[model samples]
Target: MTMDKQFHEILSDTRQDFSGWDFSYITRTGRMGSQLLSWSYGSMAIPLIRKAKSMLDMGTGGGEFLSLLSPFPKEAFATEGYLPNVPIARKRLEPLGVKVVQIEDDFNLPFQNRQFDLILNQHESYSPEEVRRIIADDGIFLTQQAGGLDCREINEMMGVPLNEEFAHWNLETAVMELEANGFEISTRKEEFPIQRFYDTASLIYYLQAIPWQIPDFDPEKYADPLYEIHQIIRENGYFDVSQHRFIIQSRPK
Candidate 1:
């Protein structure tokens, strides 16, 4: 098939409904892969989850990750800010006695003060004061965050403008924010891992799903750059990009 034909076909196939926070298609196609982390976030969270009587999972996208750590606390609750993911999360987690809440904003948590003994957050924006308000005096907060510079290489490859929102959001900034909000930081780690995309299709699909990476991204609008990237991928085996991530564990001061 011609390169143009192949590009169009890949674009068409990738433009599907990306619901439920699942990336099975990206993985199944064997087009995208990432380096493994040195430490397991799930393993670190399991013991903490088992010990807490009340737990809250922030931005529990489709509750997929939270569901795996099941046999939850007696008061298990999950909050999803994305409208599409809220219903999906409810469908998956409600059956497990997990109350899936739809939160309109991350700044304000819709719960009573000191409502939870443990809060788990993954790739979610949060208000530190709000977290401090809702968490028990001795509660724990564990979060795995996507650092601001995550996937910057992709932006450079496509000539897209870099997002400055997370430019200063690193381990130091996170620790300062948490401590400033009355939390004592116990564990902190950050990593910049390599993410490899073997095909242009995976890259397009990822950009489509994550609009924040390229705020004005549209396959049609970015056809030129996308084509250029596809040509580079055709010449090379894969495209490489850096992915920034950080994990922090803290308790009320």
Candidate 2:
């Protein structure tokens, strides 16, 4: 650990008990914020859920987003791959008559063919072919994805390489994959919006929570950049990064 007391204190902060993909601790406190997109995934999904008779919510982290979609269909199911979140999702969604299933592989979902009339995903990886297999011919699949360049500046500033695995993940490639896998794209939109961190601690908390943001993020290894960012935040009142986001609504052809 670095010997700098203040930086060390920030590193040792225990406030970031991240769970269920919730960022409320920072967001609710106005410590972190991002510019709003033109379309709201929740707004778009609500209407689809209302019209569907059976629905599936993939990667329902802690059931946070799915729980908000009230009046769930009679045959509703949510799948979560993160182990710690499975029980949490079940506890939150089961009472709403949603079956929460723990899953391992995105390519191998545990569901029957043509099982869902609506499928919703937010920031979750999915196999386009598998999605096509499980969804009804008329079923709509809605997703809001974080593109490959999301917050790339942060990694640049930290002197780290971007995660190569998702380097080519963007709206164009995603649409191409889905179209080839039998989905007819109905609506697609991509946006790059400003994301601001009011404090250096919040930025650290965020990177720590979302490990994929900087796969090799280590306070000890990146202490110099950490101090530099902290100084910038102190002088400028905030740090800024761009958010890469896209939304797609599609159905099997």
CA RMSD for every model?
1.8, 1.7
How high is the lDDT of residue 234 in model 1?
Answer: 86
Residue 75 alpha-carbon offset, candidate 1, angstroms: 0.2
Off by over 4 Å in 1: 1-3
Q: Which candidate has the top score in TM-score?
A: 2
Candidate 2: give the clashing pairs: none
Kindly provide the TM-score of model 1 when superposed on the true structure, using C-alpha atoms. Answer: 0.95
Give the per-residue lDDT digits (tens) of candidate 1, residues 170-200.
8889999999999999899999999988888
Tell me each candidate's TM-score: 0.95, 0.96
Model 2 spans > 4 angstroms off: 1-5
Query: lDDT per model, in order?
Result: 0.89, 0.91
Per-residue lDDT for 180-210 in model 2, tens only?
A: 9999998999999999999878898898899
The prediction achieving the highest lDDT against the true structure is 2
Residue pairs with clashing backbones, model 1: none
